[model samples]
Target: MPHPTPSPREIFASGPLTGHVAVPGDKSISHRALMFSALAVGESRVEGLLEGEDVLATAAALRAMGAQIERGADGIWRINGVGVGGLLQPQGALEMGNSGTSTRLLMGLVASHAITAAFTGDASLTKRPMGRVIEPLSRMGAEFTAYPGGRLPLILRGINPAVPIDYTLPVASAQVKSAVLLAGLNTPGITRVIEPIATRDHSERMLRGFGATVTVEDDAAGKIIAITGEAELRPQRIVVPGDPSSAAFLVVAATIVPGSDIVVENVGLNPTRAGIFTALRMMGADITELNPREVGGEPVADLRVRHAHLRAIEVPAELAPSMIDEYPILFVAAAFAEGRTVARGAHELRVKESDRIAAMAAALGACGVRTEEYEDGLCVQGNGGGAIAGGGTVRTHLDHRIAMSMAIAALNARASITLDDASPIATSYPVFFQSLDLLRGETLVPAA
Candidate 1:
């Protein structure tokens, strides 16, 4: 598929943002649902799957490996899985686009099967270090040939009856944890991962949902997750909740924009993924959960967020794993807060789609927000809920989160905020601008 062209857009200061809006389905869950469904024995149906390019890349890779996947007129995706240990070798290299999640997780799926495949991606993805995954996967008997520094454009040769080993994470990474668990699915005996710091547990939860035997035990180390390999997975009807990561932009925008009141519906409030909400509430954001319930084994809620006098607070380091992708937007919210918001223990931000720490510092500085950047985190001095001086252009560096976060900052700015290129937004939230327009009740014009 051809990518969207680079488009320069400007977001002007708007009146109170008010609307009941829903973001796309959880991108992480959407990717897992497709992969798990494709590994089951029968047909599985998924509703509310995120159709963004990142998730689509996962679907295409699964299809190439023999899963029959298609979308129905009702907007539900149907898949016929090839069963555990049944994936076929793709005829050519799998184009991963800009998704590190798809690239890494899919690498795990291919590691234990008896097949050889090549993986490649766009510029940003190719720059990320894959050695974190390679370390554990190699211990599991998979052979790899990667570029220097474990970059992409790598060839992986799978080993049937692969050796399953107990591995400990050197750092907290959901993608790495999920990758190890996925590789264990086709291996013999039990595959175990001992995480010293917990990450998202989507793989373990979804694994059990599909009838796989997954056990988790907490010890002095952290979360010990074990998956029994060669287990038969049953097809499931999955309903993906709204992405908390995507909902984050709306939540922060609502809190920082004066008089803004909105309800973001059906958002996933999984404890492991709700750190952004926790952090914002600590900053005195006026957010209330309505009709809280469970959807597809994850908690879901309608967030009624209204403008409040937000006060800056220290963001705890332990919350990093849960809201790793949300810090960029939180930084934006901090710029309009009452004092300095200190965020630390998030060194993982450096290895994301962009070096988020440095990127947010530079972007916020361009808009006249005082910030101190560190290797691990950033400290933003809030303006006591005042409008930001947003005359400068923000260099997005092709990160979707940076692009969207800066757009939200413009809502309370004295001048328009210019994005160097908003095309990268399509990788995750394709309709972000549309959602913004709906909330602001205005059509945003391009930056001249």
Candidate 2:
């Protein structure tokens, strides 16, 4: 069982951080590994899976649907799957706690199986718009009874012998794309998705690895992805790489804290997910990719980061999909840079665990950093490695990234920064503060 959420208030006005740390496994990959494994007929072995609450929610949901999942003392997870079209209707609502990815992707899995499953989540997850997935999956013959705006606490009734359609994405969303693909797994004929813009390709790659016939082609309009239905997936031995998203905080902390030298090992540098590193390098941070290799068909590398005088640069709109989850921390990095950093074409940030643009703007302003928020992005003026006034308490609003980002920003602050709730950090990075202590060379003392 996971520990109770602790209301830990971190106060770090620290010096140079010097250490090498390996972050937890990729959360996206961990969820997919468990999901795909549960759809295969035989036993699948997974190592390096993130044990955070979000992935655990996916695991619990799969178990409820009759997959046999177990973890060994050796840290490897084993799953005996129920095969495609073999999911049992869960007896109770699938509780998806703060994980939108699990809820959306699992909705796709349940959308074509001739079963009815109700999905519910924590307060934060229930508020996110599920209409993006609802519209497409509903088109595939699934019936949904959702909240007024297609929010969660919804029930999905799947149809057997579902209809397959070609969908051109209205927005660049990998979750919507993945849900549609997963729904196609049990339907007959080919299910096609025409993406107007590229999102993360983890699902496509992992689906192919599980012996599904998934194809990708570039046309005049964007990439076209097609998956054959009623296909059998083979169980695989998978090793999940370290998540770069989790590594973002450590990397940025090392860069901004001055005189810091650190190596983040075995991080997934998937081209689709390495946009943060590219943006940071463009901002003149001294981050080098060391020992590039491949793990479980994804690119993996060790990142060596050292403190450098950073200059803010305009982040390309095209880079948003690649590093969509990283903007909160990127904003923190920008605050310590030499000039104004502008990020645009990231409207997706508005719909995350919180309205990230608004959350970050308000938090930075509270900490005395100059920031301008936009409908799609932010413009932040750097403090040029100077002391940041940080006596204000930032409201995290149950957002894990916001809490962790503010904690990293506090390293360079003149005063101890406080967060309204750090408990949300357990959603993805449960060992985050422990790792922070390793780098900081002291245990983080929590406020009363």
Candidate 3:
């Protein structure tokens, strides 16, 4: 089998970056567009969808389920949905690759159908616990057969006459909630999910945008999200906004290192997903949000960032769910702060592609920042976002965030910081290093 490779490139401090660049579409939204399009009737057209490997897995799975998808001459993505409760038995197992979002969400979609589908993935995806999505989905009458450890290579045997149930989430997982709700789509009543902590609302928001009946209410108990089951999903055009997660590296890179000024255009500023930007602002980052608008039912904005004097603030635990994946880059920003920034309620990091808490602590310390490793989070003392001690080979453990975070860590170090196995960065941000390199080339001397 053939594979892809990410060229190893070294990052260095370049003269103040001053330019604008457009990021690709949001991966989370891209994944949902593909999946929801498959569920909606008729042809669903999507513009600005992400072309990264993870989102592509969703596209592939939809195709396997009998949806006809094509890329238009104008570069727009168009899909012919199979309609809710209209999927046919696929010829082969769904190979989800390395995407946890695709694997878990598909479980829900397959659960309420009168079909049996097998699921498998790459090593990283396989090792992840599927029981979270499995538990809630099972309560909705989905029967799952899996390995003794509850791992992948599992077969999900659907109960077509599925029963809709009200399930309050045990954790703040958008994937789990989405799985149950998707399963409920083929059942007979209202399917309710109560979440104590709000995760990303992309699923709920997009569901409504696609014409599904979804109502969200908040109270003392938490947020109760209800969806009317056994309904029709209307097909509509979707225009995905730029990804903020991909923009985090550039945003932090331009802010911490002196003389760097950049304009990141068309980035998604969805309130639920932009908490990291808020934290950076609290740290005195000279970031300005501009050109705010809406696309595909999500908020979009342009960001201008300049290097500024920095101070650290205690990060609230409640903000964890919004910016969870951006923590590695936050560590990069924290390394440059003037004081200590304490992050807690991050037990979720331990279960990610790598144990991010341990990885960030060990890497930051190797680069001369004082770091205290906690079971769930970390305490990072600052070097004032300036040139600090930098001499270490940080292991990425096949995690893209760790690899990119370490690359940004290079700007402040006295010596180059080497990162191991940056190949996986292509999973989400394929053009990341290239975009950074293009800006660097504009500022530096021609290579001999």
Tens digits of lDDT, candidate 2, 1-448: 2234658595768888898999999999999999999999999999999999999999999999999999999999999999999999899999999999999999999999999999998888888999999999989999999988999899999999899989999999999999999999999999999998899999999999999999999999999999999999999999999999999999999999978999999999999899999999999989999999999999999999999888989999999999999999999999999899999999999999999999999999999999988899999999887768888799998899999999999999988899888988988999999888898898888788
Q: Estimate each model's TM-score.
A: 0.99, 0.98, 0.95
| Candidates sorted by lDDT, best first | 1, 2, 3
RMSD from true fold, candidate 3: 2.3
lDDT tens digits by residue: candidate 3, 270-355? 98899899899989988898988888778898999999887988898888989999999998899899999899988989888778
Count of clashing residue pairs in every prediction: 0, 0, 2
Residue pair clashes in candidate 3: 16-259, 336-385
Per-residue lDDT of 317 in model 1 = 98
Per-residue accuracy of model 1 over 11-108 as CA lDDT, tens digit each: 89989999899999999999999999999999999999999999999999999999999999999999999999999999999999999999999999
lDDT, residue 186, model 1: 91
Q: Which lDDT value does model 1 have at 151?
A: 90
> By TM-score, how accurate is candidate 3?
0.95
List the candidate 2 regions with Cα displacement exceeding 4 Å.
1-6
